[model samples]
Structures are given as structure tokens and as C-alpha cells.
Target: MAQKQNTLRVGLVGAGIGGLAAAIAIARAGADVTVLEAAQELGEIGAGIQMTPNAARLLRAWGVDKVIGDNLVRFEELNLRRKDGTKVGGGPTIRVEKTLGQPWWLVHRAHLHEGLVDVARKNGCDIHIDSRVASISYQTPGPVQVQTERGATFSFDLLIGSDGVGSIVRRTLFPSVKPSPPTTNCAYRAVVPYSQIRKDPSLVELVSKPTMEVWMAPHAYIITYPISAGKDFNMVLSHHRPNPVIAVEDVDMNDFRNDYRDFDPRIRKIIDMVPTAKRWPLLVTGPLDTWSSPQKNVVLMGDAAHSMVNHMAQGAATAMEDGAFLGRVLRETVSGRLSLAEAITIYEKSRMPKAYFKQQVSFLNGYIWHLPEGQAAINRDKAMEVELKGEQPMRTPNLYVDPTTVLEVYGYDAEADADEAIRSFLEQHESKDESTGITKKEADKILNWFLPEEERFLIPSKF
Candidate 1:
């Protein structure tokens, strides 16, 4: 019989959102899990993150919502408008909650990070700070070893790379892969105290209720919403340029103000009040040919696997989904029901399609939001108006900002999908094996789902 999965020792690189969440998830699956972080302190930046119902449901199930506290602001709508504040189009977020059974939440990044960290500790996950992973070496059919910058080595049954876009783990596994530069856009982010906003009547009206205010223009857009229980307002101004003259990190307040000179005066006032801002260059990576190491004992998760432009705001949520589903797969492996290799295979098949689909849509969203002045942009606005107002017949579809589109994306449950994948895996293998379990052919079929026809010949014949 295979060893019980609870006996598995797992090591995770990076203690960011994805790693911490995965640590809690792996621990819950009855494994001994350790998270290594290069950062000296476990803290999140002061930016904001949106947690749609799909992700919020998982966090609630993991008991993270309670610790997230009342500081979370729940919203019922995402309003899209012109730079002049003219309503263009948007969807009712409450309708999503009604359909999906969980409310959408907006939160400060630090708050969400804190909640995950607290729950991870409660679940008995050993998180080591400042332990930078230098390299990973795996002896197939044996344990995987991780070397840290401090010259210490740790052995584990499996390794997970959650180390953001610039993942050393990913680099060690596939040295040839390189992430693309900024995709013609950068975001300037800032948070303003609600006190300052409330003093201005226009800003007060905007924040009187929980809403996602999106202002779209020809070559730019702005997203603003309340976070930290309305204690502060989060703003992200995204601009598109064919040839960006300055690095995103070097963008200053003057540059930010200049970009939005034509925006609504009221909105500009909010920008002026922001003491400082951080600029982030939007980055993306093409879908990988494979997400696991050659031994299949190590896997990449979150941004390391699919670092997408944040046009759709699915970056963090998708990372959470990856952790949740991985937890489920590990649970099955820990129970001695499946081999580690088989479990990771199922995890990849179950996750890659969904994640890649999200990445594609996220890229498309950037195009839609920053459409240049043309007939296409006008038609897009008209379609959104029709959808938002419930006017006219079913007509053409607005794939970008419609409520149905939102529902289709946020309605997914990663845990549920994982359960289905496991069932399929068992059925496929059990049917193929007379008494000796999966045959080489059956195992290859299960493992080579994403490989090309010519490349599928490489899987070894032995188990």
C-alpha cells in the first residue's frame, strides 16, 4: 500500500498570498507543510484586492473570512463610466451574489494577507521568513531537496513555487522561459483616507455606498473603490502607450496627474489629494508547455505559472483558486488513494484550462477597457448601455463587461472541479488496470494531455 498522504512533507517557496494560502490548504489536507519566504517580514503592500464570490467562498470555508474582520467592504455594483463621469456601462455585482451564493468583497491587500497568515499559523504550517530558496534538486522516486541562500538544505515529498512572476523555482525548472515586458500599459496606484474624501461632497456621494467606480477613456482607464471598511479609497489608473518613455516604477505624481488631465474634475481632485503613488508595470507570460518539473515532484502555482496583466482583477483570486484545488489533490494523495505523480497530473489537468482561459480573458479585458477612438469603441459602449439598462432584444453580446460574463467567470468552484478530476482519474486508471493498477499506456494518456502529438512519445513506459 502507498504511504498515507498525511505523512508527506511539503516545502513551499515564497510566503506571499499564494504560498500562505497553499500552506493552509496543504496543512488542512493533513500534510506537514513549511513555507519559505525571502522577505524579512510577512506584510502586504497597501494596495487593494477584489475578492469575487468564487474566491470569497473558499476563504470563508477555510475560516479566513472571520479573521478578515468587518474591515471588508461588500459591494453590489461595478459602475463603468466615461472620463467625464458619463455612465457607459457596468453590471450588478449583487446579481452575482444571488446567483453564486456569496457576496463580492473588496479588501486592503494587507488585511487579506494578515488573515491568510493568521489562519495558516492556526493550521500549524511552519512559515520561515528570510529563507530564500536558491535551488531545487529532485531524485526521482525519492525525496526532493531545496537549498536556501543561507546554505541550508531541506528535503520534502513535494515542492511548490509560489514566488510571484520572477520565480527562481520556475527559472530552475525551465531556464529558457522568460516573462514578457509590460504589455503597453502601467498602473499608478494610491490610497486616500476616507476622511479626506468625505470632506468633498462629490467624493462623498461616490463612496456613500460600496461600489466599484470604473472610468474608461480612449487610451486609459481608472478603477476606484472603498477598502478597509471605507476608511480609505483605492485608486488604480491604467494608461496605454505604444512606446512608454519611462519605467513604471519611476512614474511620479506629476506623470500620474498629467495622464488624467482630461478626467472629471472631481476625480482629479481625489488624485491630487493622494500624497504618493506606486507605479506597477503590467507583465504577462505565455501559457507554459508544462507546469511541473521533470520529476513531477515539483509544481508551479499562481503568478509563477500564469502571471497575467491585471485587467480582469483575477490575479490574486486565481492564485487562491490554485491553492484551493491543489489542497484537494494533495488530500487524495495523502489518503494513499493516489500516487504523488498521478495526483499532480490530475491537479494540472484540472487547473490549467481554467487558469489559461482566465489569462486570455484578462488580456482581452485590457483591450476593451483601453479601446482607441473608433467605431468599435462606440459599439462597445452601446452594447454595455443596452445590457446595463435592459433595453432592446438579446442582440449582440458584450463579452467584456456584462453581468452574465461576470457570472460565468466568478461562478467557478476550484474545489468542486478538483473533486471531479480525481473521480475521473480513478475511473480511467481502474478501468485500464486488470489487477496491477494503471498500465504504462494508461498513465501516459493521463499525463500527456497538454503535450504535442510528437512530444507525447517521451513519457517513460515504467511506473
Candidate 2:
């Protein structure tokens, strides 16, 4: 008789955009999910989050695209400009309305979380808003043990640390490594009133137009993208190092404006018009050696795995991608005859390389904002010129979407993908058996080829 599969239970820490999204996807897959939020209340007071088409495509597949569509400012083009206001070169969006099957939107962070929270609740996820995760236990092959600040304890079959870069789950799993050290790069984020920029026709034109605009300077760059249905502009002004940390409690422009030196007068005017501005230091985090820990059950996702420079404006998008991928992998394991440990190996083996590639890309693209002696600036302009000509030299899509094309992505059919991964594995194994009697070591080498070249380095050669 077929052994009845255990009901997969999941515990997710941090109910930020990524955690909430994970809860919704996992619950929808009929897996039990419980999400814990440290904050007493869920709120997003910061500026805008840029969710590109690759992330949007996955959101659409999960059935929340309508919620995303309701809060979109579909950009028809993306314009790049120099400090003197000369056009560096801009191009039509590959993800404009009707292009990638859905319109990409930039909504306020809090609102997006609210939508996902509702979806999670409706899909049967247990969400506790006021609870804080104090610690985690990962010493066994069972569910991770979570202790909340309020002394509440819970356990589940899978633990996902979707928390921000300073994840407690990460620390518990890998205690020796220093947590993502705070960086010297600080960001002053704000959302200005539309009427303030709307009065100026030229500024209004840029803000009103359906596009993401970047004004690059010697040491800094300002990214302004439309959100709130084109009525509001979400602006993120960032620069290079040694910046002191800013308090998150309130908006203080006095200290924040120090970074905006020599910016355009209009840009200054918009900055002056913002009612609230909060600053935070930017940090980059890489993949940990043990994503699944000694327990072999808990996994970290989103910023907990790879935190990149904000240059790509993909902090949230990457997290959403993590949630979607996790759901797909778990669904396959439940349906395939594989054990949870085997499924998680497949998950880490599949996702780590993709996440690592994105981290590297973010690091590379970050320099485009600051070009010493204009060398990097020249490369930027050249690429833009090529793009404007309706051509691209490297086939690099905006946001560099090479990670989404993995077999895990194309083969993701919920349960079917697991069946297929297994089917493909067995078929090849059988063929080998019929031919020359392949060893277990040979079988693993063939199966692991599906993982990226970087992660393929993880398996020690046993043959």
C-alpha cells in the first residue's frame, strides 16, 4: 500500500512582503502555514518599491495579479538622464502594458502587504501580527521550534525565514557568521505629493508619463517611478559610502538632504516638498553555506539569503520570487514520492545559484550610478544607445532575468513538475541500467546537472 503522505506544515517568520506572499502561496497549495510578524501592526510608510515584470509575471501566476493591477503605474518607457539633463538614452519597456501579459506596478509597500495578508488569511494561513519570533530550534529532522517574544511556542514541518536581512532564523541556523553587517551606504527614501511636481510642466511630464526615470550624477542617483495610479511619484535618492544611520521613527530631511548636494533645483524642490523622510543604511548579504541548517527542515528566503544593492530596485521583487519558487518546490515534493529531505535538497540546489546570480548582477549594476572620470558613465551611455536602436548587446533584459528561466521555472507545474523531475530521473536511470549498470554516484552527477554551475560545486565528488 502507498504510504500516506504527511500533511506538510510550514512556519514563516516575518510577515513583510515576502513572508506574507509565501504564506498565501503555500496555503493555497493546501499546505498549512503560520506567519509571525514582529511588529504589532503591519505598515509601509517608506517610499515606493519597484516590482519589475519578472516578479509581476510570477505574481500573476499565483492569482494576485489583479490586486497588483489595481495599484499599478504602467510605464511605457524608461528614461535615463545625466546631471545636465541630457538624455543618456531610454528605451521602450519590454514589460509595458500588454507586453509580458501583465502591467508592472509600483505600489506603496504597506498596501501590497495588506493585499497579501488578506489572501493569506483567506487561504487558511494562521497570522499573528503582534508576535515576535525570539528564537528557533533546528537540531533535528523535524519541524523547527519557534519561541515568540511573548513566550508563545510553535512548531512546523518547514520553517522559512522571510524576515529582512537581519533575520533571527538566519542567526539561529548559522550562529558563527556575523549577521549582515550594516553598510556605510545610507538611503533617504520619500514619496512626494504629486501636486508639488505637477505644477512644473517639464517635471510633470516626466512624472506623469508612464515610465521609470533615473537622474544620474557624479556621486549619486535619483530613481523616480510613478505609483498610486500615476498620481504619486515614488523617489529613492541614494549615494556612496560612510553615511551614518538615520532613525526609522520619523522623517528628518535636515540630515537626509546632506546627500542631495548639487542635485537639480527641481529635484531639490521635490525633496523640500516631501512631508516625511526616513533614512536607513544599505547592506548587501550573500548566500549562507547552510540554507537548510542542521535540522534539514528550515530554509531562509528573500533578503535572508541574498541582499543586494538597491540599484536594481529589486529588494521586494526578489523576495516575491523566493516565495513563488518555494511554493513550487514544496508542491512537487508533496506530489512526487520524494521525502521532505530530498525535496528540500532539490529546493536549495535549485534556488541558491539563481539567487546568487541576482546578487552578483545587483553588485555589478550598482556602479552605473557612480562613474569615476565618466568611464562607467560612458559604458552606461553606450548601452543605452544600443538599447535605443532596438538592439541589446548582451541579451540582458532590464533587471537581468536570467534566473527565472531555470528548469525549476519552466518545469514548475505544481505537482506535475515533481512528477516530471522524478520521471526524468527514473527514465534516465532505467536507460543507464539497461545499458551499463550505472552506480549511485553516476546517477547523482546526471541529476545534479540540472542545477546551476555555481551550486554544482557543492556536491563533493564521491566517484
Candidate 3:
């Protein structure tokens, strides 16, 4: 007779997007999940987030799409231009949805966070906002133990560090790992009301429809898109500096306008209309040798595992992917099909290389986009122009429109990939033993577990 398996208890640090996402995914898979956040209140500080198809599909599966409600903006077109408003590249993103089976979305960071939190709670996640982690014990333990700053202690079968760039859980697990160094790049983020944008005839076109626009220049670029259901225009302005401080501080409006003084007149007007903005110093962490403790019970996910700059606009998307993938693999462990160690091994093996690749690509994208005015920049512009005109199927300098990159980045299916990995592992390990060998019946059960009825998880359109 087989022993009855108890539900897996998962302790997750951080209640941010990634943590909440993990909570929802794991809880839905029958794990008892608890989330601890350092902040007294749950919220996000950024202006807007680009929820690409890869992450959007996971959100849809977890029913967070419905929770987003009126805050979601589905844009199908992106326009890329030079500093003087010369159109360089960009086109319709409708093909992306058609190819990838999910639509790209834009939303305020706070709104998305709220939606994730709501769905996580509905999925039975016990989230404690004021519980700051003081220390963690995983070195010699049957279960990982966490101590909060308030002297409260909790133990769990698994500990996930989904905490942001500064992750205490990660630090505890890997004492030798150093903090991410500050870069010479920084970004200013702000949200302008559509009503304010309407005041200027030149800006009215920007809000007339759901679209994304990027104006590129030497060592700087400005990206804008509609958020809050087209009621607001979110702007992210990236630039270089000789000495950039690592902090989020209020921008000096005068200095901010002067920095982009050479841009188009319309851009200058838009900058002037901005009442306030916050400057965020870009920081990135190099790939670590591993993202798991020696015991494998304690692991890292999201930014805690692979923090990258926002150059690719994939920082949040990749974090969501990490959470989703972890949840999928851990489900097998909960079902007694795989050990916790085996599940963590699969996760580390599959996610580490992909996440590290994205990190390097994102860093390289920053260099590409911030090239000085020279032959390199001109060649980049010419390539984008040719690609936009459909003259050839060759790779474009703009990653957003590059066919290969678009497919690789947006067309990924985390659940499917995890299922395949599980299948391969079972075939290799379980097939060797006659008693433990996977039978047809067992394989069918695993397939069913991976592919639940689509209708059961579909988000309603009128939610």
C-alpha cells in the first residue's frame, strides 16, 4: 500500500507581482501557500508595465485577466521614430496574438499588483504584508524555517525567494553573493492624463487610439503607451549619465526638460505637460552559479534569481514566467510523482539558462538602443527601415519586430515546456525500474494533469 501524501506547504517571501503570481499558481495546484511582504501596505510604485504574451497567457490561466478589468489596455500597434520624429520602424502587433495565442497588454503597475493580489487571495494564499523576514534556516533542516522581524517563526516544506532585486532570502541562502552594482543608466517614469494630452492638438493623435510609440536618440529613448483603459499616457524615458546614483528620487522638472531639449517640438511639449516624474537608476545582477540552496528545499525565483535591466521590457514578464514554471514543476512533487529535489533540479536546469540568456540580451539591447550617432546607428536605422517596409525577411535591429526574437520571447509556453521536461525525466529515470516504470495509464494521468480543460480556466470577456 502507498502512503498518503500531505499537501505541500510553501513559504514565499515578497508579495510583489512575482510572489503573488507564484502564490496563485502554487495554490491552484493544491499547495498551502503563505506570502510574506516587507511593506505595511501592498502596492507597486512604477508607472506602467508591458504584459507581453508570454506572461499574459499565465495571467489568463490564473484568472487574473478578469481581475485586471478596466485597467487593461490592449494595444496592437507600435511606432518607432527618431529624435526629430522621423519614422524608423514598428508595425502592428496583431500578428503576435495570432501567432502566440495571447494578446499583449499594458496596465499601471499598481493596478496589475492589485489584480494579482485579489486573485492570489481568492486562490487561498495567506499573505502577510507587514511580516518582514529577519532570517532563514535551510542548511540542516527537514523543512525550511523563516523568522520574521517581529519575532514570528514559520516553517514550510518549500521556501521560494520571489523578493525583488534586494532579496533577503537570496542573501541568506547564498551568503557569498554580492549586491547588484549600479549602472550608468537611469529612467524617468510618469503618467500623463489623456485629458491633459487632449489639450494639445499635436498630442491628441497619441491618445486617439491604443498604440505604443517610441522616440529614439543618441544614448536616450522615450516610450509611451496608453494605460488605465486609455485614460492615461504612461511614459518611460531612458538616458545615460556619467555618474548615476542608485535611487528612486523625484526628478527636477527643469533638468528633465533640458535633458531632452534636442528632441522634437511635440516631445518637448509633452515633457512640459508632465507635472512630476520619478527617476529610477537601472541595476542588473550577473548570473549566479546556482539559484537553489544545497538542500534544494529553499529556492529563488523572479528577480531574486535573475534580476535584469528593463531594456527589453522583460524584467516583469520573465519574473512571471519563473513563478509560473516553478509552480508547474512543484505540482508534480506535491502529487508524489517527483521528489522536491528532482523538481528543483528540473526547474533550475530549464529556467537558469533561459533567464540568463534574457538577461544578457536585455543588456545588449541597452547598448544597441543607446548607440551614439555614427555608422552603427545609421546602419541600425537603415535595417529597421528595410524591415518595416517588408523588403526582406532578414532580422531587424529592433527586437520588438524581429521575427525570431518575437517568436522566441512571446511564443513560449511555460506549462507545456514543464510538462515535456517532466515527461523526459520520467522516461529516463522511472523507465529503468520495472516497479516504478511509467505505464500507459500513468502517462495518461500525467498528460491530463498538464492539460486541464481549457474552458475551465478561461477568463470571461465581460468580467
Question: Per-residue alpha-carbon lDDT of model 2 for 1-463, expressed as tens digits?
Answer: 1233658889999898888877877776667899988889876557678666656665666666566556755677777777655666666665343434544567777667667776777788898878888878778555678899899999888889988778888777766655342445556677876767888775756665677777777767788877776667788877655554533334456756767756666677777777767666666666667587755688888888777667766677777767876776666555655556665676676567766766666655556565554566676676666655665444332332222332122223333333455455445444333344665456567755686665543344433
Measured by TM-score, the strongest candidate is: 3
What lDDT does the true structure give each of the candidates?
0.82, 0.67, 0.83
Please provide, for model 1 over 1-463, each residue's C-alpha lDDT reduced to its tens digit, 9 standing for 90 to 100. Answer: 2466549898999988888888888899988999999999999975898887778988898999999988778876777887888877766666567768987888999999999999999999998988998878875568988889998889998999999888998898888887765466878888988888889887766878778888888879999988898788899888865664233475567877989999988899999998877777777765898899877899999989988878878888898999998899899888998888888898888788888899888878878878878898888787777656744324323442355566667888888888999987887665444454555465576766777777553434443
All candidates in order of lDDT, best leading: 3, 1, 2
Model 2: worst 10 consecutive residues (lDDT sum): 402-411
Q: Which clashing pairs does model 2 show?
A: none
Task: Mark the regions of model 1 whose C-alpha exceeds 4 Å error after superposition.
Answer: 1-6, 139-141, 241-248, 387-404, 431-463
What is the descending TM-score order?
3, 1, 2
Give lDDT for model 1.
0.82
Stretches of candidate 2 above 4 Å error?
A: 1-3, 94-102, 140-142, 179-183, 243-252, 386-463
lDDT of 2 at 229: 65
Extract clashing residue pairs from model 3. none
Q: What is the per-residue lDDT of model 3 for residues 242-308, given as tens digits with 9 covering 90 to 100?
A: 7864767787899888889998788788889888887887767658888998888999988888888
CA shift of 356, model 3, Å: 0.7
Question: Candidates 1 and 3: which is better by lDDT?
Answer: 3
